[model samples]
Target: MIAKGTPFVASYSGGKDSTLALWRAVRAGGKPLALLTMLDETGGRSRSHGILPAVLDAQAAALGLPRISGQASWGDYERVFVEQLGRARAMGAVAAVFGDIDLAAHRQWEEQVCAQASLAPVLPLWGEDRLALVREFVDAGFAARIVVIRRDLMADDYLGRVLDHALIERMLADGIDPCGEAGEFHTLVTGGPLFAKPLALADGDVRADGDYLSLDFGLAASI
Candidate 1:
């Protein structure tokens, strides 16, 4: 773990969870030097949440911090991610923060990657009640939109919808994880307490790839 007040890097996906984790970390007095995003092989979108680089750049700008990214396909994902952490280490990050909650495998992988990069793995939401965490996010008034959904797991109509308490309750009633931790869906945070200014995004095309449906979110997101 990082010493109190020391700077660290966050494994940011530009999603609700990651954004919340970083915000909480800052609130606890930790200094953040940068946000590290792993990008797909094309270097266009984030690997985890499929957020465009331009939008994430806007997020970084809003937070007034630098954004660092590593690009790779599945074959080289680990190597590239470790390299990004290496950069984080060089930037004086003693620990790396992630947003995972209650997923053992995800924690394990995070630990392994942090180990390889000589940094500690920190999960602020680890082992917390999932529903309570979702409530916390909603109460915080952070606005996020469901950008990608696994059509087999959830209805395609859920795409591009704003995430809120009512929708989360519906998800729970449908036996879906409120946080969509099981690959059911993913989101992009548009505005939050941590943002100096809200992202001005336009909804874009809705496209299907395999069993997944994604919204480009009006492709030209900027500050």
Candidate 2:
């Protein structure tokens, strides 16, 4: 049986890592109380990859999770992010889950924030083998698509492609991190083992802005 009253918040980015992390948390007998995402108010983008907020909401709904989001400018990231987390804490969340792998600076920042909020930081995929983890995500029935690609490291052709074993193999063969930890690519989870339903998105044009190539998906009719 899962632990009762152990409210936990999953830091969701609509990415494979966050999807896998939340799945692991659920499997570990923790109650997922909420999902948290940071929205960029200035550019109407997700902080990490510039995905549309509407798409993120659709993904959250598919996961059957309530989301608590905050909009902030680039300069206000740390403050607004922490404030949103504190709100989650006030709602009785005891811990926060992250899907980070082998990023010391990220881990340190997460620890600091959790400490401030008095919430335990859980890194479910930390220090795991990147290639193995990618394989696991695909094999475990998660449906992820490359929504953003860094132009210098990866071509724009990868945008909007499903992240499967074939994609993982190709990435590995190219000496790129299978998980795209080095900003080679970013993904959005449309369907996954943890989702109660699949997100319905209308395909939009891919736009290139400076160093990033982003695929836009707008909300169609919800399924």
Give residue 195's error in model 1 in angstroms. Answer: 0.5
Candidate 1 error regions (>4 Å): 1-3, 218-223
Q: Give one digit per residue, the lDDT tens place, for model 1 in 125-210.
A: 88888889888988997999999999999988889989999999889888888798898999998888888988889887787889
Residue pairs in collision within model 2: none
* Candidate 2 lDDT by residue in tens digits, 157-211: 7789999988877877777787888888889888979778877787787788888
Per-model CA lDDT versus the true structure:
0.88, 0.85
lDDT (C-alpha) at residue 132 in model 2: 88
C-alpha RMSD in Å of predicted model 1 compared with the true structure: 1.7
Worst 10 residues of 1 by lDDT: 214-223
- Pairs that collide in candidate 1 are 202-218, 203-218, 204-218
